[model samples]
Target: MPICVYWGEDDFAIEKAVALLRDRVLDPMWTSFNYTSFPPEQADAAIQGLNQVMTPTFGAGGRLVWLINNTLCQHCPDNVLAELLRTLPIIPENSFLLLTSRNKPDERLKSTKLLKQFATEFREFPLIPPWKTELLVQSVNQAALAADVKLTSKTAQLLAESVGNDTRLLYNEIEKLRLYAEGSNKPLDVATVTQLVRNTTQNSLQLAAAIRTGDTAKALGTLADLINASEPGLRIIATLIGQFRTWLWVKIMIESGERNQQAIASAADIGNPKRIYFLQQEIKFLSVEQLISCLPLLLELEISLKQGASEITILQTKVIELCQICRGS
Candidate 1:
């Protein structure tokens, strides 16, 4: 029997499966998910740790959910997994076992194994294309549904585009929005999504959003994160410049009477039509000057960061100043 693996490039699907399993196994009053990992060489240690999980707790407590998130097969050539197979029959009902891995187990294990006979549930995760805005919305709606929160299709679309591919951020933003929507008649549209789903770190769009909102502190902080991520000043500038250029290209395409989404996506070389579709709606908000200004400062920051100073501080100041300039401050 194959170990239930939630395998997906779509972080949301993997997380959903994991969350479902975590809830099922965990006793709300006692404990939550416990995680352990094993590399190919860490078989012995992994075995010991997993076995410890099976041991009974003396004190009064709820169920403990176990997640084996690793890159190795616990069973080695010496039959580590086979031993695991044998032990499955004895796993206590108090503990739930969940495996979230991206490996393909050996054929022998799958062929002769009875692992499935033990698991309460088994399912694989699904992958979603990064540009699937509709699917992204659906995912958000599903997560919201899990929490008993209602989200409109428009609101879901806005949230998905605003949050992009970061599932954790999406979850965080939804938590915030759920609080605000308690008694308010206001729905989650682009403007509300913009206000509620603020990016905690800076990216090309984060900086742009900071500029759009005249947020100097956030814009500066974004630069700090970029630096910490080892993204060079030049690269950041190049990416922003490219984003603007893409927007400009898209703007020109729109002006040329391309009304259909497929035509606009192809014109802009957008691999994801879903992104291009919403991007068409967003192009009107940005000005050409903002893009032009960002490029020169990015170039300056590139030079300053490489040669003249504490690269972190200099880059931070440059970005804050850019945010100020864009804000007309």
Candidate 2:
């Protein structure tokens, strides 16, 4: 084998590996190649093909890189590939082949007769799905380690909850925290975390609620709060209009016998999953006028915001106007 190879769904590990390759350590001999993708269907082709390319000694005396993936390895013919492998001995010193996949290698890996001999020195890292409860804490800690900072467990957990449990988002949030927390040794508490992290979720939630309640002042306040926090005014108005329209559409759909809130929530692709149950109660009494009247106000806000109208004022007017309609004013 050339040097090292990887197998996992861990994007972080793959990213680190890529960084090392990009840096290209000279004295100890290091190089890297990243593949576009690798999926399960291409497994057998990958094994035989990689074996040929990743060898111990280079004929030309330099490092080799064959970053194998689903598309690249899926169609290689077996016998011809075996012929390529026959030219190189089992262990080729100067070559390194790295393979990555979202899905872990399975029984095929364990049972593959061809790969059995090479399995001894093989480094296999499988990315396991994290428990929902522990995910945030783990993500924060991992981020801290990467940033070379000491993040407290409490701080880490708090930071994790602040950002949704998406690893990619968490990665971005942690980077922000690292920069803000620089030269500050104090463990990040919720207050510090909150100040540093923008709560776009709350902004979205409040804006949606303001639109729903039709309280123009509340709507304007929410918009102002968002703008003060550096969110684009146009995006806030647009997202609110979209979400409210979806809510109204689903409300109408439920009235027409599409009453299954879970089904509605799935189709709509917004709203808290928990809110699905609450929505049934809320939507049950929604009048067609409530939806009809609010739609124009929302459209007006969108148009005005887009047209460079005073977004804050338009939002405020829209909110108050919506509340009146919703409340049968």
Candidate 3:
């Protein structure tokens, strides 16, 4: 029950969870003496952390040794693995060892299997993909509850759309809303969210939507907004590629006479089968050929961006071409 493993792309969530765990397990008065942390850059961090956790507590409270950005689960050297094998099972009852990484642990690795066998708490904090609206809405609702802020269902949806998969932004916005609602009796409404939350409505996902609808002007404008907001060009292209690829899969499946929603969802890698209905409607007007052609252009754009091309100029040109393709011109 003293060994914990937390891994995922959701850095903010993981940090928050670690802080909570530290507070819950370590006594506040003796925190300075009881806590130790190993940064990823440190040499032999995993081995050092193992040694630290196996040591007895100093004074008043239990000990906590954190291995931040640990990669042992991904690639454990033999010596480190040996240390873990020796130290983990015999860790002191008054001490806790916590390992955190942004990468998912490879289940096939001996280190990962060992952690699975011994870790009392193993959790993943994956970031929800921007295309998944329902999950984002649920995330907003849960954050609101934790912040003691009440929001109408519509307001939660609006916040989700506004923030997308940015957990830190979502939490900050919810806290801001909570402060604004401190004296009010009613739950925050859509209008209040619109008034307070900075309109990040212009994002990569909106760019994809504009391209799908063949709105060159809208696409270009959204791209400008994103660039102005300092969104990285490669990140934008990545999102576009993922979105178009999903559309292509859905289109291909439906055209192949696949009627099972679950089957299409699975093939498309969509988490919820219910979303298959909406995706079908969204791509109903587009042909498989058009969807198929988009991948090359997206790949080309990614290449150009990585090759030191001007981001704004290249993005603008490709966005127009994509819009034209979607329009069947």
Candidate 4:
């Protein structure tokens, strides 16, 4: 019950969780003496952490040994695993061992299995994909509830669209809205969220939509807005690749005579089977060939961005090409 494992792509959420755990486990007066952290760069951090967690508390509080950005879950050397096997069961009840990582622990790994058996808690803070609007809206609502801010359903949806999958921005915006709602009797409305939250509606998803519709002008415009907003070019390409890949999968499944929405959803990695209906409608005008063609262009765009080409120029050129492909021109 003294071992905890937290791994995920949502770094801000992980950091907040860690802070809460630190507060719960360590006495403020004795924190400096009792809390030991091994950053990823520290040599033999996992083994060192295992050793540290076995030590008795220094003062009046429980000891907490943290292995930050740990890779043991992904690949633990036999020696480290041996140490964990020896130390974990005997760790003092007054001491806690915490391992955190950005990568998911491989369930097949012996180290991960051992940690699962001993860990009191194992949690993942995965980032929601941008295309998953329903999940994003739900996350926004939950965050608003936590921040003690009231928001209309429309306002929650608006905030979700504005912030997308950025948990840090979502929390900061919710905090700002909470402060503004001090003594206000009404729930925050869409107008209020639109006024306060940075309007990032012109995101990569919007760019993808513009391309789907063969609107070269709109696609170019959205690309400009994203670049102007300082959105990373590689991130933009990544989103495009994911979006296009999903579309391609859906198209392939439908064209292959797969009628079951759940099957199509599963094939495309879509969470909601109902969403397949909407996606089918969106891509009805395009053939599988067109969707297939977008992938190479997207790959080229990604390569150009990585090679230090001008972001705006390369993005704009690729956007035009994608629009043409969708347009059958």
lDDT of each: 0.59, 0.56, 0.91, 0.90
Candidate 1: stretches off by over 4 Å: 1-43, 57-67, 71-75, 102-114, 147-150, 199-329
Worst 10 residues of 2 by lDDT: 25-34
For each of the candidates, give the backbone clash count.
4, 16, 0, 0
The C-alpha RMSD in Å for every predicted model, in order, reads 9.0, 10.8, 2.2, 2.4
TM-score of 2: 0.45
Give the 10-residue window scoring lowest on summed lDDT in candidate 4.
192-201
Instruction: In candidate 4, list every pair of residues with a backbone clash.
Output: none
Q: Report the error of model 3 at residue 87, Å.
A: 0.9
Q: For residues 166-283, could you state the per-residue lDDT of candidate 1 as single tens digits?
A: 6777787888888877776555566666676764334555555565455788877776776776655655555555555566567677777777777777776666666775666665
lDDT of 3 by residue, 215-304 (tens): 999999999999988888987898899899999999999999999999999999988899899899989899999999999999999999
- Poorly placed runs, candidate 4 (over 4 Å): 252-266, 303-310
